[model samples]
Target: MAVMTMEQSTSRSILPAAFRTAGVDALAMIVAMVLAALAIYLFGNAAMQRVVTYAAIMLTAVLGLQIFSGNTGIVSFGHAAFVGLGAYATGILTMPAALQRTALRDLPQFLAGHEMSFFTALVVVLVLAMLVGLVTGIPLFRLSGSSASIATLALLIIVYTLLVAGREITRGSQPFYGVPREIGLWTAVGVAAMAIILARLFRETSFGLATRAAADDERGAAAVGVDHRVARLAAWVLGAVAAAAAGAMMAQFLGAFSPKDFYFDFGFTMLAMLIVGGMTSSLGAFAGVVVTVLVVEVVRRFEGGGVIFGLQMPVLFGLTQGVLAVAMILVIWRRPAGLFGDRELNLLRRPNAKMDPVKPATDVAPTRAAAGPISVDHLSRRYAGVVAVDDVTLSFEPDSITGIIGPNGAGKTTLLNMIAGDVMPSSGIVRIGAPVRQASAFRFARAGIARTFQNIRVFPRMTVLENVVVAARVVEPGLAAAEAAARRELARMGLERFADRPAASLAYGQRRRLEVARALALKPRFLLLDEPAAGMNAVETAELVSILAAVRSERRIGVILIEHDMRLVMNLCERIVVVDRGRVIADGAPAEVQNNPAVVAAYLGSRTARARQGNDVQ
Candidate 1:
């Protein structure tokens, strides 16, 4: 009976327990899918079978979209492009050879000669979709939020235009026909079930969780060594493949469809399903499909002027579309997260989570004590007329703590960002061992440099242990190994007791330590801490100083510490680098810098220094 603490329970009252358990959530999906199969088998006529089969097809496509859109928190409207490609691929291949000779005379030689089974066509569709995903993901992933969404919409338009203009192969917008209809109710049900299972499994994998962490906070994920580009691209390709499969299945099910079938109308409907159900989980996808299908069916009956039992109904034009629009709007207004809202129904017993007291590793590998010193050679960063870091030169040695202290806007953080590869330098180079060329944040992170932000940026949705495990995965390949390492780090930070608690439930000081713990999980050679002691009380600050001492003394890890606390910096650092107005003002030992006249004037002001010394005490 493992349960969250009082603090943890209080923070996520709206979240469901089942949503967090993969086994339970997956079982719920299996049950719903089985019930759908049972219903179709027991009482389905030709028309009823068509309705259920169409719903299953929609579910498959929606689940595919959920893999990327739900997990990455990026809304995409371009999945239909892949669907359209799949439809064309299947249509061209599965169409009769005689029809291909007569109608698709303008198609490529290879395509016109090939007419394959559904499985073979599906494989080809998947490969083509993956190729498109790889090409498009490179640039699209560089942008975020609304910009990324708009770019995907642009992709839809581009693909649609290409399909329309490519008249030779596709017969333009005139609708190419004569395809064999091989997809049946059982086939759709089986594929839909597979899609649901795949989506759920992917969402629970280490790679999937890593993408979600990035979606929550990109900078936080980067600082912890998550490769943002790679994770997003993997998801994009996977989603594209799934979408392609659904498209092939739909083409075979519908018997014939035009380019318009997979364009805006289909794309918007699929996206709306994901949004109205809850884009974060597969259960939401399933729930949305069921609700939309039911609503559409009822509205269609009214629009057709049908008789319900005995009485004849009045005809209602566009009623089906109007109802769907209103339902989507109402869902958005009332429950913006959708009806299920990332929750899944659970109906199974599960094993309890093991909370074994983790023993310290007997043979813990030591951090690189003699990793070559990080050298900053006249590094500069300028935006328009403003210079954030102006030709600052410094070198940090291995196995020592170097303190960077200065007033606000003195470029201390800017220097760290350049070294860590967050900001590209306008001029000069940052060499970290062997003169490495072209440094980026991911490159520096992989090269044994880890940093923490001034404002704490822990992934709020992840547990205390998960936050550390995500970073640990960079160095450790196995999930078991990573979780074990994360536990050790948490124990070292005295956070073992709160391992299962969400990061947001921790106190301010605990959150700060968690950030440090996450950084340590990277096995960094040089740690860059930006104002780590910012929001700490006296006791907490002293604890942080002690923890830093242990990190240097025990692990032999070098630290570049930035702090406004003069006492802590002066006492802890062996060498101090002081900067003022984007340039180094003084660089020396604590004793020398404390007494230097320029240092005193820049930090304390001449009058304030004199007043403190009783020389200007009116």
Candidate 2:
């Protein structure tokens, strides 16, 4: 019963409320990183300093993994290849003259003669890794779940094979030496800090928000106009860059390494750090790195028989590996969401903040005049031997509500899906102002066509307002404007009360209204609703009808509604289209379609000749 007004959702600033809040989280991270660096520099011994540097490098790599895997909820095992690429690229470009002359006799002519500074080497490798990420991510990221994981593992094997086979470049399994030991404690710390900031900032960006939305639900995000491939690719490239930079630093730190250095061992360790701390938060990644480094150091000391106080600790066989394995297991078993989950570190709250009542949108909203009427010309869809929608032709007028009604197994949903670009029409054209050149969900949405799924597809992890904001941003230029638009739309749907709540937390009816609000946020020319009133009760149905009427009247947008509720359709629609099996049977006013003989026969079965004539009809 509590509603979040516009004033409550935003403050007097150009930045959106969400971004403003993220600034505080960023500050917390900055403070923690600076303090940790200071502590290492002031009190640590030489061994401690080296350990800190190594930990920082690991943190950078883990943060990279966090960006792609954590945000997109897709695990990647190929970042190890990126690490190797960075290390090998740096080594090849900076090998000492003597070593290069002796070991790289058959190396590439340009590479054999070059020796670059550490900074220059780092940049080159970073760019190279990102390029690799872009090329591989296009096809690899297209797969999801285990398929994507397997593809990434295949990439690791491919890179390993290339490194092992390229004797001239990588020395063919022999250690590549003569790399400059340039990554000191302070340099590693500085790079790690910068990487952390970049990782955290990316997560707060609008693109990041959209990527997370798509991760939560693909169909839902596409309906809101999110392009999944583009978002995923962007993250993948950035992540590769981070991992590459870390690898370059590690190369300089170790001074010599083999292909095995950047293989399964390194990749799994980074993944474990990410998962144990929390994959979704930058703070979690940082914490995981710190915890794992300490654990490994302690175990390493025990492995070599360290003297503690007056006692001698005997050497232990495989203790470090066993401890790390057990820790990873316990972490996964107890907290799958990670220690911090998706929360950021924040220390203070402004208790004096007030929630002011907001005025509903009057004429402040911008107009979407270019979105004209939509026309479907002979749209047909066939699956194998069955025709889901056969030669369906319909034109939805501007500022009007058209309802599609049919019995079970009819083509209503299929036809709607085709128009929304979720399903491709076997043969026909869908013209929205102009003939759609391509039938894609995002393209259709960009062309001012928005839709809601038959089954609700709200981003379960995102807040109700965020769900609308993601869609609104497709049309609005700025995040601030999108937030404003989303708030207004929520208010219009009476969803303002649940604005701050998670979309998954809302009641079933509220989720339906949230979907409508999300669709409207696109400023669409045509709004397609597929059984929007599917599970609603009498009162909810009436309210939905009113809302649709308001949307059509206020926005001057055409609406195509697919509904099974006869009363709701009969009362709310101005024009009705009826379909039987896969073809349109009747189209006219509600009353005419309701009494059509074909409609009756489709829904209630055909009548006998005597019954039709009303002569002693049984």
Candidate 3:
């Protein structure tokens, strides 16, 4: 027995770090829930046991929502539709043939004649829910923000309407009876436990991490090669499966339910539980369900006119909903992120050891073996008739460091943006290995181009290591390899010490370096940096120059920089392109550009003139 235990421990230690953490979190949650259920079963009456079962079913449903909405930061008001579908499907499939003939007389012959066991019926319901989610999500995921949320609300209304009108299938707003009450307290708890585990595991996967990165900052995620819509769609399908499972369990628990059971009121209650507890973690889903269930039980005792403090009270029709609404408002007001705010219950786990910084591989190669020079031909961009990049032509080789020095509004960043596929050119061609048309930033990133924004854009809520891991996972095959690559980049940028900390906690200079590290993880053929040194002190700027020079030499990849600091530009760049008023004024070696009359007039100005006069005086 000891030998078997040792083998199991050794095997578990080799799993990816993220999965291991998630496993521990899931175990902790399951233990807590089992203990609570045990107490209820041992001491509580039958009524309390039924309430616990109901709460367990609700927990499963809410966790399903967290899998999609929490990771993608998209509020979904339509998930309850899947829950309703699950109930109807389960009732139709599992009801006794005699009962089905009487209750759903017009149901399809195939469905009316079936009497499936609980587990078999659940499988069929889940598949139906997944198909439905896939069809609806194709178009809905295309829209984002408030628009996507409102679209979900519309979906709920549509599903509700269908259920009410489809008398043959759903009994038309009447109770769907005859589903066997096979799900007792233990069965419901078992399903909820599975949901909690699945939710935690999914959050540690590449899809969940990428979706979360997009939620933090879409532009940043794009630079790391994440397609937000695709990621969200995957989450939506899985969430639908979970909701359907919960709905099946609920149907058995009730033995009868109607479309109204899963409509507006139920939807609001599920969302309130999520919002009030926290939406970002599985622990929050658990906490929210527990709190909401307790509130409902207490409020129900007095809602129908009960003696309180030895006095008679009047009946209150909507007291439960009104109180829940106020509770949600108070929680949102006091803690906008909810009670636990992305934190998990990890009391049962041991503290993790500090990760040792790994040296970057010496033979790291660019993403493409023969990625040619990036060329821009007669590119121009206009904003309301005002030219931002005017008829610019430039070529950047894959084995050189070039600096683009220009005054503010001189269009250096605009040209960079066009090359990186963040902005469209008014009329021109951009060839990164080949001429491209209408490419998005993520596509450009996947095609051997990576860039840093003019304004620093890091995933603030993600760990410093996770920000790099998000980029690494784009190219690496698995989470373990991604984490290894991320550690290498963090070590290269001297950010390994802070790897476990949230990116938002980093200093301005550190965040700037963090962005560069994230870009490097993509292994791009061309690195475009915009104002990387803007907020850095002299020491940090000098360090950045050293790092950039080393990276360009070691990787043999093209580096195009836009900077206002003349000293750093002159020292680090092998070639300089000087621009003034959206036009290239001079393009040559640093010494030649420094002496050019046009360049001096446009940029160097009084500072260069004064320094020269002092040199002559000395």
Candidate 4:
């Protein structure tokens, strides 16, 4: 037997082997689902079992939707098309050749003559659905917000039309029967369990984290080097695969169906489940499915009422739908974040109040020699006819603290935006090492540039540690390495204790510090800060000054700050650039810029103008 070294033994015993591979939340969810399935299997009648089985299938589909819509905050109305495709593909492949010869005679010769097992048909359908998702996502992911949602709705319409119009392949909205009814309650329960695990695991991956970050704050995520389009596309493809699986099961369960079965009504029902339960987590998806299915079943039984309390009851048409709609509205009004609110159901105790401190990995540190001064030449930005930044040529050294300050509307923020690649220059060049020809924030971030917004843009839905991890992942190779880097930054910024707390729950001063920590986690060669101390109190401002001083001393990275806090500017910045009315008026050491005649005249004139305007006000 070989003896283990102390270091090896310590590492091995640090965390449970199972938790290293999976999260507590995922395991808890799986257990809950299994128990629920067992309850139905043991006690329910055949009819109740059937309803639960159908609910399991719906859960799979809803989980798929949650994977995309929940993470990207982009509601998709077209995912049902993938479900429909899966059902039709499975049916066509698994149906007997004899039946295909009669019912689907117009199917292609290959499809008409062949039949496959349920598992094989499902595999084929999943692959086909992924292909469709990729092709559609290329165009659809290019859009965001309401435009993207509308595009998805259009996708559903197009797919529905194709299913109805392709008379030879689909029989043109007619029922295509003879599908093998091989799927039972156990099969659906197994698939749903798998989907739940897959979704939960994906949510913990780097791609999923990036997608959720982008959903929370697009510009902020971009500033941390997240590729929003790529993240969204990955979620889109995965969600389609899940939806396809659900469709395969549904086809075998029902044995026969028409295009209309997966049309508007079907899509709306799936959407309702996601909305009512919560659109942000796998747990919410599960809860929503159970609640919706139970409500629907109960209401359905009373639709053709016989009697209640010895009184005759009239039949109520569409009562289930009406009640569902009202329930969704209530959930939206009372709990807009959904029932779970982006949280997982974890019954296990939190492993530890604080994460084990990990030393900073040397390989992930910033290479000082690789950084060069950022040069901006004749940079100008215009909006319509008004110039936001006009011919403001400047250079920022790689190891200096520079401040750009003036009265309100002095274009300080605009100038910083141009340099950080958040805004396009109308007619000028910004060079990190070479001229950057495009305005892309994520590209700049990946090239050793990181920034914080004037308004705090932390991903509010993410934990404090996760906010920094998002940026750290840009430079680190894997999630573990990224987390180590993040924790190091959090400790340095005095946020280690609040690592598990939501970013939105932090105090204003703490949020400001958190933003700085997030920016620092990128190991950027240049860091741009806009009004970092805007809402901070005097004590917080003093702490910020010390933190910035230490950062400059330790990292030797260039810092460009835009603020109206004169005391902070005078104390923290070695060099100052004064801008007024979109033009640079003075630049030198802080003392020199402070006393420059042009700087004094610009401030005095602006104050006078403001006073005159106030006097003229009604």
Using lDDT as the measure, what is the rank order of every candidate, best first? Answer: 3, 4, 2, 1
lDDT of 2 at 164: 94
lDDT per residue (tens digit) for residues 1-618 in model 4: 123244334543464322344476776766777787789889988887889889989999999999999899999998898889999999989988898888877888776766999998888998999999999999998899899999989999999899999888888888878999999888998898889888887886778889999999999999999999999999999999999999999999999898998888888889899998899988889889989998999889788878977888899998887888988899999999777767766444352377566543333347642578999999999999999889988999988999999989989999998888888899899999999979999999998888999999999988887799889888876666676678889987888888877899999889999999999998999989999999999998998899888877777889999988999999999999999989999999998997899999999999999999999994
Off by over 4 Å in 4: 1-22, 347-364
How would you encode candidate 2's per-residue C-alpha lDDT over 254-324 as one tens digit per residue? 99999998998888898888887998888889888988999999878778777877888888787876788
Candidate 1, residues 269-386, lDDT tens digits: the string is 8988888898888899999999999888987867878787798887878777678788889999999989888554434312234456765442454446567899989888898998
Best by lDDT: 3
For model 1, name the residue pairs that clash.
none
Candidate 2's TM-score = 0.90
Better of 2 and 4 by lDDT: 4
TM-score of each: 0.87, 0.90, 0.94, 0.94
Count of clashes, each model: 0, 0, 0, 0
Candidate 2: segments with Cα more than 4 A from true spot? 1-13, 102-106, 305-318, 346-358, 362-370, 606-618
lDDT of 3 by residue, 1-618 (tens): 576456335534466677878899899888988999999999999999999999999999999999998898999999898898898888888899888888887987766777999899998998898899899999998899889999999999999999999999888988888889999999899999999999999987888998899999998898889988999999999888898899999899889888899999988998999999998888888899999999999999999997898999999998999999999999999999899988776443333446675766656666573578999999988999788888999999987889999777788988999999988888899998788878589899888888999999999988888899999888876787778778888988999888877899999999999999999999889999998999999999999999988888888889999998989999999999988778898999999999999987876674676789999999
Clash pairs, candidate 4, are none
